[model samples]
Target: MPALTAPAKRLHAAWLASHAEWGPGLHEDGFGLLPEDDVESPAGFEAWLERLAADSARCTYRWITEGELVLGGIALRHEGNNSVDRAGHIGYGIRPSARGRGLGTWALGQMVEEARRDGMDRVLLVCAVGNFASAATIERQGGVRERCRNSGADKVWRYWISLGQPAEGD
Candidate 1:
């Protein structure tokens, strides 16, 4: 895993090639792996990467790669504001061909470790009710469900994972 920096341009391109539907959950100028618009030109891609590197206030996007092959991406938000309310602190995805190999679990564990390193003793994770795989991954990482609620068209499960000593709300 590595931070999305200038050198990760090739990795970004590879990810975009394999994960075409990545734009759906991504926000404009947010810390996701990609943006809503298609980066057609090389210059446009570079510009997007530059903007991603520059945006540190929102969240941090990390590429989960092995060698030069980009497998997936994970994000850790800096605050619990905005869409973070339902999305929670971390969001991640694996490439189509890379699923079912336990990479998602590993990446999520890494994100939790990253959160602990960043001083977040406990972190919240919310997953869509229909996404049973994600919920299982979170549970495998010791996440305990706090509640469930209907959000928009889907029901979401809110979970809390203690990174260190139990926090006030944990």
Candidate 2:
């Protein structure tokens, strides 16, 4: 394991400061682990975080932070999309402050590496049809928009990222 270097630490600080909405997270584990310690109940978010922290089937990590602010994060679902189409197994979100900077694409890109490291056949990502940013990000990541369908009321676009395969980066 590698310790968080100074540059990475700087990015984390920028991230936290940028997303003060999640201010308390900065104090958790001192690296934005979502310190929900204030909550005593073991059935709500506190429990959820605890479970999330302990789970091995899935992992959530900050791809990069622009300070304490989270530029975005990457989550890996070990189940690897149970649906027939191999829906994406990763989820991500860029801090509002970091939006429009291509961070989502970069975040997701790093997630692909994470998926490979976690041993996956591929990743399937679903994006809202109207979310041009997501669409753009997916495209840049070599996500072939397989199809679009209605999910209750909103339209969704499905993308595929083959595992054990070199991504656009490789």
Candidate 3:
């Protein structure tokens, strides 16, 4: 079974294999990777992990894994940051090969519970307008469509999931 695990150096080799499948760039979303994040070197990867640890007060990151395979990642951004306003409270992505397996939905459900445990009554999730898979995942978690807004060149759909209520279609 796949589970959400904290980012760790022990999974470096598995992470690299997954990253290779993602090709290049920091578009992995939930990994919280930045342009300066040098994950290629052991030292740099350790530093990057430290940075994520330091930012834990503001956000939480987790990898969706089954055994040693790094399947994908998910992140929950706590309130009080401008990013929460613009990017929403949660962001996630599954590896291309891992898509269509319901991992995103399962991970999202777990993250929603985490948000509730953290005292958030609700959470906002946004995805590109045409990302049906992501939209469906959020909807399965009881995400209600709030609006669609233009962000850069893409129109993104914003959704809100209330932690106080049971998920829709449950």
Instruction: Give me the candidate number with maximum TM-score.
Output: 3
lDDT of 1 by residue, 1-170 (tens): 43332225666566566456445555311235454544656776677667767765677777777767667777787665475777788877777677788887898888898788788878788887878888898999999999889888888899888888435665
lDDT of 2 at 43: 40
Q: Which candidate should be chosen as best, given lDDT against the real structure?
A: 3
**Lowest summed lDDT window (length 10), candidate 2:** 1-10
Backbone steric clashes in candidate 1, count: 0
Ranking the candidates on TM-score from highest down gives 3, 1, 2
What is the model-wide C-alpha lDDT for candidate 1? 0.71
**Listing every candidate in turn, what is its Cα RMSD in Å to the true structure after a full C-alpha superposition?**
4.7, 7.1, 2.9
Off by over 4 Å in 1: 1-7, 21-36, 165-170
Error of 2 at 69 (Å): 1.7
Model 2: CA > 4 A from native = 1-48, 59-63, 80-87, 166-170
Error of 2 at 79 (Å): 2.0
- Backbone clashes under 3 angstroms, per model: 0, 22, 0
**On residues 1-170, what C-alpha lDDT tens digit does candidate 3 reach at each position?**
99999999999999888898999887787888999889999999999999999999999999999999999999999988678877789999899999999999999999999998887999999998998999999999999999989988889999999998546665
